[model samples]
Target: MKCPKCGKWSLMKFYICKNCGYKIDIKFEELVKRLTSENDDIFVSGMRDACSYTHSNKFYGVYAMEEAIKRKAKSENIDFYEPGFTYRSGIEYAEARSELLSLARKKGFLADVHLTQELISIWLAMYTHLDFNDLAEEIIEISKGLDEIHNFQLLYNQMHDTAVLNNNDVQRE
Candidate 1:
């Protein structure tokens, strides 16, 4: 969630904004409603909330993510809960997909998510095909040129491995 006072992102588990020390009493359900709301502005607000919350943890974050996907489906006039309803091609769907993938990527990096090089390659490929900037301001809040990125690696080998995997993916393609 964002610090209402400073407008900076913060983890939902935190009641005080780290940047401005503003008290945050927003309810989780309220965030979810905004996420699933029909209003675009409200949806973006909810996306920012989900993005920050997912940054630190994936417990309730999953629900927030589900709501996003469901909203995307609704936008495309598809029933997300329908049996075997997978993905659809649409502007809103693509936007939501990219945002969700960015969130997953950030969550993976933050939580030491591990996969075979093959999987990582697939992930990188998908990410490359989509616009990373689509919902970046609201979703993945990457701190460019900061040690926060380099230091968040849970394991030293994981960081190096990710670099190697990216190189391999480039060479293979």
Candidate 2:
């Protein structure tokens, strides 16, 4: 089995992520049982738990959850939207991330200082993660250093330069 938290392969018997110690003991049988449950709370809880396990692109639980969602909606005679994460190839993921960052930059450019700060906060949250610890720390420090509204322009300039560089890099690739 793959550990949903760390994307590492682990023996099924271990029920743990070898790299991050995240619990991977999702009981498949129990999850299926809950899907068939009549109680709304139990079924909904199962679905929510299933969504969390979707970080592992290879995990079967995501498909099971999708099927369960479809079955439930059909039986209940309603339209439905599946509520779990979708797996994307590396290139697709990169493109989506780039688009999102571009949108944020454009919006921040037109926004007031308060809105710009909010946008920056959201961008940092989405961009910074464990894999980029040093980069994340540097970004956080830069954001913090921009204490005055006047300094916001500096941040915007840096973001624009980054976007230009990212575009060049992508083109080269």
Candidate 3:
């Protein structure tokens, strides 16, 4: 296959073009389908491993999981349950997942399960909705009872950096 931009011929099976940084013989739709669905569990596990290894940046893993969920939802035609608001039609779940993941990437965390579940509790009198801050706090609290408390600062810094980088990328784009 040849690089469309530079017309470079190479025998490399799959690679970005070295000559002009053009991609050769690529199928974006197929790639997206595979990343989003095929062997999804493996992808999720990879993201989880990345998170575990880095220790400071779990948002990447979270984003990967979110993407997988979005893809599955889109493929299955599942609608996100937005409490109180009428369900929007023709909404692509993968896009929604991307949006949520982007939000988390910028904001530093995804909503914890409990907070996400409690979004319907209007009587709780919470002005703000559930979000990543709650999750970070929970992690910190849990670490206090374990041997991992020493590394909480690193994780916090990583979250902050990730948010900053995501925000910068958005502004630039």
Candidate 4:
């Protein structure tokens, strides 16, 4: 396909234009879904590994925790943006969290409800960090106002807990 911005003929299916640095044929929604799915898987896998290591080796647990946090931050940042800019940020995060919860249940880790809660909280905090109060409030309002919205309360609660935890952590350290 030819580049939209630049009339360049290339064999690449979807990519930034080589000639004029313009984007080629691509679907933004599809890209977001694909990325969110991949990131969710990575975050879940990292969390599982981190939890497994927590009992045997503190250092490995810490490392895995850090990696999980990084992955979560990246996923949240990519998925959470202006409403018109992206459509599936909150949905993706919620879906990912649900999947993680299922996995945790299967692995006998869901009994620690607090851990799951903390994970969601951390994700919200990271998301809010990327998007300040104004954007966050806008996003929340939009989510709440939408009739089709799901898990709005869950995400909001998580965000609240995240803020509290973050403040406490900062005070402690």
lDDT of each: 0.42, 0.43, 0.36, 0.38
Count the clashes in each prediction.
Answer: 0, 0, 0, 0
Report the lDDT tens digits of candidate 4 across residue range 53-162. Answer: 33343333333332222233443222211111223466556564454445333432223334444444444543655443443344335434321111222233333433
Which residue runs of candidate 3 sit more than 4 Å off their true CA positions? 1-50, 75-173
Tens digits of per-residue lDDT for model 2 on 1-173? 66654558776555766677787546764675565465657755755565444433223444444334334333323222212234445555455434434433443322343334334434444465563354334433544421221223223332333344344442211
**lDDT ranking from best to worst?**
2, 1, 4, 3
TM-score versus the correct structure, for each prediction = 0.30, 0.25, 0.23, 0.21
Best-fitting candidate, scored by TM-score: 1
Residue 10 Cα positional deviation in candidate 2, in Å, after optimal superposition: 30
- The true-versus-predicted C-alpha distance at residue 125 of model 4, in Å, is 18
- Where does candidate 1 stray beyond 4 Å? 1-26, 68-173
Top candidate on lDDT is 2
Q: Compare candidates 2 and 3 on lDDT and give the better one.
A: 2
Cα-based RMSD of the predictions, in order? 16.5, 18.8, 14.3, 16.6
lDDT of 3 at 144: 38
Candidate 2, position 98, lDDT = 44
Overlapping backbone residue pairs in candidate 3 total 0
